[model samples]
Target chain A: MNVAVCVKQIPDSEPPALDPQHHTLVRDGKLVMDESDSFGVEMGLQLVEAAGGGEVVLVSMAPCGETRGLRTALATGAAKAILVSDPVLAGSDALGTAKVLAAVIRRLGPDLVLAGTESTDGYTGTTPVQVAELLGWPSVSFARHVEISHRALRVKRQTETGYEEVTCPLPAVVTVTAGVVEPRYPSFKGLAAAKSKPVEELTVVELGLDPSQVGFSGARQQVISVRAVKAREAGEIVVDAGEAHERVISFLEQLKIL
Target chain B: MDKTWVLAEQRDGTPAGIVLELVTAARGFGSVVEAVTWGPGGAGAAAVLGRYGVTKLYNLGDIGESLPGPKVAAAIAAQLAAESRPDAILIGATHDGRDIAARLSARLDLPVLANVVGMDASGGRLTSEHSIFGGSTVVRAEFTGAVPGLFIVQAKSFAAEAAEAAEQRSLEIVEVEVPDTGPSDAARVVTRHEEEHSGPKLDEATVVVSGGRGLGSPGNYALITELAQLLNGAPGASRAVVDAGWAPYAFQVGQTGKTVKPVVYIACGISGATLHVVGMRAAQYIIAVNKDREAPIFAIADLGVVGDVTKVIPRLIEAIRARR
Candidate 1:
């Protein structure tokens, strides 16, 4: 049960930064494995572990050819990683990012592909499904639980009404939602071993992906503009009095329907 | 014909609330508003949708009472591949809607602007305004294509209103062509359960009370829910609590979860993480109770109480009951 997990190295920011030239996320600064992708990595590692023998591989695209984010996942039991770093991959939209991931994944030829439902930064929530399409595989998105069998995978797909048990054959894509499983923290021994693990770095050319088909030129959607969210103007701050609950009641009463 | 189409979601033979809302929102795009629906119960929804200015309806016929994701996606692609393409296709930001949009975007090779709050076409092109970064900022995106723009608008992004009797028009039901063999044939729901949640849904509730990691454990989450029940509000959880398995994902309200804007929101045991703030900042009135005085939630809280939720929530519930 070889698994490939798609991870994104996103900037760690209170409010994310944008590259002025590209009007996209500024990725040159400190990068961490996107919190969302951690679940996918954790899920992949567990699936491989449950299968008794196989490897968990991570795939990520970042600027500066940074391995910081990849190291974090590698520490959490991923056998190795594939980093696709190039100036040409910058400003790639969801679809372009999916293309890069799908290409790298094809090389690994993993039996299953896993990804986060959406990244916290861009939050387009489309890349996983796009990767499935690019690979011509069935996708089960918003999965809270997935049981992988020898020949098939059953997913507890989340929905507004609750969950649906959806099954698909092997070689499928599944996107795990947040808190699907508690991600394991990298242990001291795991961290030390990760330092020596092999991380295969590749370029678009190596993956047979056209550079022009990615980055700013390949992007279907344009930012057009980026602006800060209007600061939520603070209204009132009250220290808790002994009768603070009364204050809340009075506040509701002021609305006249309380 | 010149038109825009809306995917009308339905339940139990009646249109889902989002369908009527999308119909009202679709009115902004064009006058010849059409609708498409799958399965057998769509006929009952046609008149309701017509009241909201849907002039034509595309029925994909019966596929039973299940979410036929691939079948619906292929059907819509077949429609788009017809002699004429619509100006735009609007779908709600629901789970099934996202699934459909993802598949159609792949099958049709079209771009889908998702989580859209609003859209307009003034400069000879349609641009969607997305409320990103937790609705703090807005990004306006224009579809490059000449026609058949795809957008998955968030629920309640627009107000739903009834068209005047004179404005109401008859809708034409056109049969749609669905692929005879597809993913739906093999997929079946083995078991399904709607969570037995009390009060309204966190997204739909007029009042929402939420908890966070500060709640300590799954047992403590009950305090948040109890207060919510007292207020007749929905109980929501921050991503931390939801991710910690303290509460169900459906209870999560954050950037990654559902976006909720209730009349009044009560945050208990929450540190006011930025992601959590984005989802609930739209509330008309916010009351945050955290032991940490400097929790970021205070910045946005209309009234901030620096205290322990364990101590405050019980008292607050008592206060409400006493007042009643």
Candidate 2:
């Protein structure tokens, strides 16, 4: 019942400054773990704990400075952390990122892989499905709840209408929505224990991944440009000092509310 | 030059709303629009596509016997890749369409754009516009490789035109048996649950009435619904209301919820978070009603009524009914 959680280091949505010049996010040299990925990590931890024997591995692709996010995952409950970081990995979009993740999952040979439905920054919601395609595995996205039994994994997916329950065989990929579960914070003891855990660092070359196989160069899709949205104009407020009923009637008449 | 291809998603043998919208959006490009569908064997899904001005319709007969993401995507991609190399592809940004678009983009080695609100071809390149940062900003982009462009059109962004019903024409139905690249490990579809709501959907409605956290509790949702009914439109909610469990998540209009481009959007008891406003900024007209005159929603609202929703909504509903 081995499980792998693919995490990404994304720019915080509330960035100090947006790089308008480059039309890219400027982190001011600070990288934060995507909040959605935390749900995937928590799902992995829950599965490992329920299985009572398998391990939960945290996998990520980030720069050297991004190791702190991996460390934080380890502190939370992951058995170990694997970092696939290199200069070549920069500017990889969802598809390329999924390819790298699929390669790592193949190397680890896990029974199940879990990922967040979408990262907050990119918000593509495509990586997990793409990764599942690359790995030739079944993928269930927007899974709100999951139960892994001996032969199959039962899941509840949130749809526009209502919740859908589905059961798939083992060795599959599941992408969880934020509503899936509440992530746990790293405890004091867990933080100390995480220091002793092994952290394997792998470069693209070490993973035997050809430089041409991952990143922007390998990605099929490219973002040609990004522009800031136009600022909205302020509205005129009509404040009438009248009785509550009179004011309500007058406002409705003006707005054609009636 | 090879023409563009549009995947016209159909449910139960009829083209979905977004499919028509996709075709309408792609019509201005002036490329040969080939509509494709994967449905039950011998189903007349292809015949229906012709009404949408699809020059050619490819019905890859029921590849998976049921609508599964990978199976449908593989079948369509394999056919499109082998038969006609399209210069670009368009799909609706629905859950099912988005899944297939991602897989198709990966398989075809093309840049996949999602949530494109508008697209125009200029200087031999297609520039697609998308709303980012919860709709606060609009970004235009283009693909940069030999591969064809792939885009997922945002829902309700384009108005769907009813294609003229013409004489029945037979379309080529190519059946491509996708190789079992992987085991069938997906959870089987056991049952489906559909919510019953009257009136038009909020995203497509001409007028939308929405509630926010200012509506004290779930019980107050009736006021929002009454207003929507009076307007003969649809009801919507801000993320705060949905988060508060006063309304269903499907009714939420925000960064995580549905993006709507309606004619008139009225926000009642909403403070207007950027996330919420982004979803509705594309609306032709916006009106905000809140007790706090300085609520952020007022910044983007075309009209503002500074009043308490609890007092205003009931009176408005009564007055509208009285007029009738």
Candidate 3:
């Protein structure tokens, strides 16, 4: 009864600016675990706890072979961590990412896998399903609630109209939506334990996967260019110490449709 | 004319509104448009296909009950394998639609472009335009695969319209063998609990009034609800507010939420994170009220009011009441 929760290390969403000339995010400082994955971590911990004696494992692929993001998840009470880091893994497309993650997940042999609906930076929302496809397992996306019973996984999946109740056996992939649950904060004891939690690092070759098939070399899509946008200038802002609402009404009147 | 396909969904035994919208979008590529869906109960639902001028309807017809995602994708792959592939496949970016697209991409060894706002066919390839980084920018990409380019277009991008005259189209009613994939077969819908809701759906509202973290507390959301009611608008919440439990998921408006193109969108106490802008940037006119003039919402707003929502909202309501 082990659960593998996939987490991502992302540049702060509110960065002052990306590196101007490089067309890349400024990863110079701390790269935090995306808040998007917090639900998955929390759900994984709760499920493992409900299962009586299982462990929640953290899995991630970080740039510059980083582990700070993994440590962030570990601080939430995950038992261990696995990171796939290699220079060759840089600039991979969603498919290439699914390939690397699938290979690693296959090796871990977890009964259930959880991932965020999408990363804040890359919200493609395709990698988890691709991983499921690659593993030849079942997949459920947009999951709002999940429960494990009788070697099966049941979920409340969000849809456009409303939602539906769905279930699949163990060894399936479920992508959790944000705000599904209130993620627990890392306790002081949990933070201390995370410092020593076993982190196993791996490369493409170690996983018996071809380096050529794991990264930029194998990517089917590439970003042609990224340019900083000159956002629209701020409009007429009326600072109303007490009459701001009246000023807004007059402004709307000026538009001839007040 | 090249053949194009739409993966349609059904609502209350009729083609869903978004499905018709997608069919309208597919009309741009070529005249030969078709639709694929499940459920035998939707035979009359097949007539809505005719109204959209879908020449052919590929109905798996409920081979698999609720977990029809994998089976539908399998049926599509089987069709593509057995016959000439369609030039493009347009799918709604709903939860089930994404599941179908993902499984199809995996089965076909092709990349599915998700979150496309618009699309075109050029030189035998489908070019997709996607909004990225909170809709401040957009990127154009083309699928370089063989036939059957997969696109998951965002909802509300295209307006749904019925054809001038309902054209009687060819119907291809074929049942597919639901392959028994081993354990971990995509989960099945065992039970359902829909949040009881009433009011205009968020994306369909002409007037939307949204709140954000600036509302201060969950209790403060009462102001937003009352303001929206006074304005005759649907209530929306920034992702931050919804994430903080001040509002429910249905009230969220932002990236990864509903993309709304209302006639007038009023922001109450919203700081306008780029993510929220990405979702509501299509509004015809935006009026934002935030005490901080530096809030990014002002950058795109037509009129910006620097005042607290609690103060400004009640005053505006009074003004509207006295004037009306």
Candidate 4:
């Protein structure tokens, strides 16, 4: 019942700053665990707690051999972590990421894997299923509720209109949505213990991946140009002055919505 | 001309609105447009699809209780393997659509350009435009490898338009076979639950009133509901309030939630983080009501009110009721 959770260490800013020249996200700062992954970590911890005889492991890919974010995730009770860090891995696309993560999961041989439905920064929302595809494992995305029953995973998967109760066997991947579970705050004791937690670092080569098939060289898509979205001109700003509602109602009247 | 394919979805024989939108987008490629669909609704949707310029409809037939991701992807991949490959595959970024696209990408070892808001096909190459950073920036990208690039397009990115009467032709129906890929396609939907809801669907509402953390307490959310009901609009919540458990995730309007493009969107006490703004910034008109005049939500708002939502909402509700 070993569980592997995919966590992303993202730049610690909302609307992350992009490199002026490269037009890419600036990742050379203090990175933190993406808030989105916190839910996956919490879900993995609870799943292990319910299983009663397993450990939750963290898997990540970050630059500069960083483990700061992984330590935070470990502080929440994951046993250890495996980080794939290499300069060659920079500029990797979603499929490249899925390849690295799938390789790591295959090596660990976890019975079940968990990930956020999408990273707050990237929001591609395709990596977990791609990882499942590469691993030849079943995947259930947008799981609002997940429970293990006799080596089978029962999940409440969200849909466009409602939700569906779905199930799959072990050795599967499940991507949890944000707000699906309340993430626990890291205790002082747990934070102190995280320093001693074992973290194994690997490179693309170590994972038996060719450098040519990763990063910019392996990227299948190229950004042609980047530009700011056309700005909408500010219409009107009115203070409450005890009659702001009147203004809103009048404005809606103009639009005929009222 | 390039061959463009759209993956369509339908429920109970009714095509999802985005499917028609994808069909319209596929036609924009100025290529031979085709469609692939699954479930019992596939056959039922062909006539409407034909009118929308889909010359051929590849039906995967009924997939039973099996989750449609792997099965549909396998079926599409099988078609690609057996026949001439399409130059482009357009799929709506819906729940099952993402799954099928990802699986198909992995199966074919291809790349997917997701969150596409715009597309341009010039010189026989397809370039996709993605709206990012809360729709504040647009990035144009294209695939450097592989044919039939998979694209998961955002809903409502394009208008759904049917063909003219003179151009609507008889559609060709092709049955696709789903290859059994062992346990990888083992997930099954055992039951479905539809949460009780009333009023117009959130994304389809002419007017949308969304509440944020500024509403203070979960009980205060009643103001949002009351106001929305009075306006005949749908009530929405920011991710902050949804994450705080004050509202159902269904009410969430944000990057990870439902993208809403209403005629008018009223934000009550929402600070307007980029995550939440991305979902509603496309509204025809935005009005922000926040005590903090400097809130980001007000930056994009057509009308800005510097006031407390708890105080402003009740007053606004009364005014609307009086008008009625």
Candidate 5:
């Protein structure tokens, strides 16, 4: 079995301040791999472990030096790391991003691919399905559990109501949710081993991707402007304990709730 | 002149609420809006679309008897390609909608904008509006590439238009031969488990009363339910409350759960995490009651009551009953 886990480096959700001018993430120079993607990495590792003998490949598309995230995946038991980096790949939207990933996966030729349900930064929740469509492969989103046999993959998908079990053949894509598996922390020994493992760097040109087929120019959607939400004016806090009871009654009556 | 298409979702023969909302939005862009439905035969799906002012309705008959994600997307994509080229296409931002929209975008080789709150078209370009950074910021986006721009509109962002009485006219239902997609070979729907509680759904409720970890345990959820009943609303919980087994997953509201846009959202014990706020920030009015005055929720709340939820909720419910 060959498993490929797609990871993305996103701005922390609780950023101190998103750059008001550029509409780009003002990381304060602090960047980390998306937490949800870590769950996918763990799921890939579990599948390989269950199969007894297989390769878990960690694939990521970030700036050249940002392979720190890929190295971190190697620390979590990924056998190898593949980084797709290029200067022209900046500011790519979901579609452009998926196109790059699909091209890379086509070259790698993996039996199964895993990705997080959504990236923390984009939050579009469309990458996995897009990649599957481009690859002409079956895709299952919001999967909570997955069991792979020789030629079949059984998965339990989390829906609005409950869970749905579905089985698909190999050469499929599965987008996992956070509750699927607990991600493991890098141990001292694992960290040492990761430093010695091989991490391959491939440029867009080296990967045989046409420059015209990637980045914001190739992206179909463009963001015109981004502005912070307007703050609301503070209302009076009913502090009087004796009058608090009466105030509550009056408030509910005013709103017509009573 | 090019027009826009709205892929209206229907259940049990009737168009869903968000379909009318999307129609109302498409009309704002000065484009001819077309409603398309795919379902079982004799479903009366087209008649329901007429009530929402859907001028052109396409009912793809019995393409495998069941409308799975991939088959429906492929059928619609093929239909659009054969017909007049649309300037933009909109879909509801539901679980099924997201899946189909991504596939459709790929099949059509178009760029997709997901979770759009609003849109505008000018000079042969469509600009979409989205709420990002946990609803703390709003962004306007457009595609500089080509026509038939694709987007998925967020549910509950726009109000559904009321049905108006109009003369009934016969609509042409174009049936397309959808290839045998083989049961979504991608993913299958196994079972749907309904929550035990029979209260109103949190997303559709006009008022929602929610509790957080401060509620202590599952036993104290009754207080939250009592307050919801008093207000004729629904009961909701934070992710922490759901993870602690105090509430079913259906009642949880946040980035991971359902996003709600209610008239009033009352928080009992929640500390107002950004993840939780994104789900409820669209509420018309917010009321936060917590012991800590500095809780993050107070910043976005219209009314803040600084006190323990156990003490405040009971008194608040009693006060409402007395007023009644």
Candidate 6:
């Protein structure tokens, strides 16, 4: 079955730098594939391989029309990609992102859609389900294991306690949990092939979306203030010196944990 | 704010721990607090919910084996369409909670403020505070459109306390009629496999011992569980360890994993990535043991120990055993 995987190209940083004036993340810089999306890409590739027919399609949104991250995923094995990059889409919230992605998926009409449980940077963890809802399709989130057969999907969904085997019909959305499958490293031939792969770019207007409904203009929330949290003061730090265990014992004793 | 709603999720015929926490937070909005619950536990949880300031409760009845996301969202949407809208809806940031919130937001064409850690209803408006960059920065945001703003609150963001209602009035439990959500409700659970865990629940434990990549290998994780067992605590793991297949995702503690607030948290070989730090920095006391003294974990750790986890964990385990 054809799979449309939602990939996010986020700023690569330990803690992403924030825009001082806007109180939002600075996304105009170099972008890379979010590590979390790698799992989804790998899962999609495997699903396509198992299906033995349809191809994997990458769907993503990035500011400044950057495709550097999409190329990384393309190198892994996706047939092609659809990138939605526009100045108007700069301050899009989860809902707006979902709107764009849902529109793209609707156009492709893939048998199944895949996404990460959450992005490492934004981490809203809401976009996949939002896309599913907007498309009027069933969604299964936090899937650790997924299998498709006879035009149906079975997923091992993660919960607080363990996992539940969930079944949904075709044309559904499933968000894969990180590390559920090992992502394959791009081979040298694959890397060379990615450069020649097709990437179709689209804009909000081209997608028939209202300007007032897809970006900073369409944002429903405002960041009022941003401030640094009071750093936690460090307590006693002791070297091992063959006596570190005593310190832990004494500390726990003081807390009555011992 | 005239009214607020809390989505009540239950486990084993009892409300989830975050249900009351959401109710407690709803009370702070100075509105008529109402709760919505699905399946078997609403009737049983009403009195306790009332004790925590929920004035009304809505039961959508049982949903059989169908997933709760679509049906629950449709039921709540029906209530909104049939009755007056509330000022806000509070949902826990759990697996099902996110699903319901996303569907509800899409159905209503409204935006949801997620990952909320704190909120204030000052000056006749509600603003939410989100802990970002691994608890290093707090961002306050507010919705600009539509009534009944949706907030997916993080667990342990508020203390759950029980208190009698201000007035001695009986709680009104309303039975909500669910609407057909069509194919959206097609996902069904066929089987369940709950992992067998022996100690206290990870998020509820008074003490938590988490291991990371610093443990070197999966076998070394035994030291973590051993230490936790000796201390009557729970075992946790950083995202790295979980991703490395050293532990289950249920044991993962990070921004995308479980948020824990134990009294004491011991980190073995953890480097304290920002994603992992946000989950446990709320613990009352933190101790980090790493061979690299410059690990970011040391910056926030209440007690930092410079030593190899494989070597130091065994020593600490022996000492604690001797004390007992």
DockQ of each: 0.56, 0.50, 0.50, 0.73, 0.53, 0.83
Worst 10 residues of 5 chain B by lDDT: B60-69
Provide the overall lDDT of each model, using Cα atoms, as 2-decimal numbers.
0.80, 0.74, 0.78, 0.89, 0.76, 0.91
lDDT of 5 by residue, B1-324 (tens): 257778877766777677878877776676666776776642476666666656677666554423256777787777876877777778987777788888887777787888788777766467888887667778898777776788888777678774456533454555566655543445545555455466677788888999998777688899889988888899999987875668767788887787888878888889999778888888888888877888888888888788777777777777777766
Residue-wise C-alpha lDDT for candidate 4, range A179-241, written one tens digit per residue: 889999999999999999999999999999998777777777888899997877676888887
Q: On TM-score, who's better, 1 or 5? A: 1
Taking the tens digit of each residue's C-alpha lDDT, what string does model 1 give over A31-150? 888888999999998898889989999988864689988999999899999999888887777777888898998888998999998887887788888777667777788899989886
Clashing pairs in 4: none
lDDT for B80 (candidate 2): 60
Q: Quick one: RMSD of model 3?
A: 3.1
In model 2, the number of clashes is: 3
Q: Which 10 residues in a row give candidate 4 chain B its minimum summed lDDT?
A: B315-324
lDDT of 2 by residue, B58-114 (tens): 666654423267776777666765765777788876666767777776666565777
Query: For residues B21-47, could you state the per-residue lDDT of candidate 4 as single tens digits?
Result: 988887878888999989977899999
Off by more than 4 A, model 6 = A13-15, B165-168
Q: Which 10 residues in a row give candidate 1 chain B its minimum summed lDDT? A: B180-189
- Encode model 6's per-residue lDDT on A1-258: one tens digit a residue: 899999999987655788877677999988999988999999999999998888999999876788999999999999999998889988889999999999989899999999999987889899999999999999999998999999999999999888999999988999999888999999999999999999999998888788788777677899999889899987889999888988988888889988
* Model 3 agreement with the true structure over A1-258: per-residue lDDT tens digits: 899998888876474345544333555456789889999999999998899978998888754677888887899899998888787776566677788788889988999999999888767788898889889888888888898999888788876545788878878999998888889999999899999999999887887888876554565554444544566556677887887888767765665445
Q: Number of clashing residue pairs in every model?
A: 2, 3, 6, 0, 1, 0
Candidate 2 chain A lDDT trough over 10 residues, lowest sum:
A240-249
Model 3 agreement with the true structure over B1-324: per-residue lDDT tens digits? 388889978754687667888898787665478888787565666777877778787776665445656777877888898888888899987777887887788778777777888776656455778777766666666654466778888988888877766444655555545555554355677765665356677888777889988887899898877767766678999988877878777788887778899887889889988778888988878889998878889989888988888888878878867887
Instruction: List candidate 1 segments past 4 Å from native.
Output: B64-67, B180-187
Higher-ranked by lDDT: 2 or 5: 5
Residue B89 of model 1 has an lDDT of 88
lDDT of 6 by residue, B251-289 (tens): 999887889999999999999988899899999999999
lDDT preference between candidates 1 and 4, better one: 4
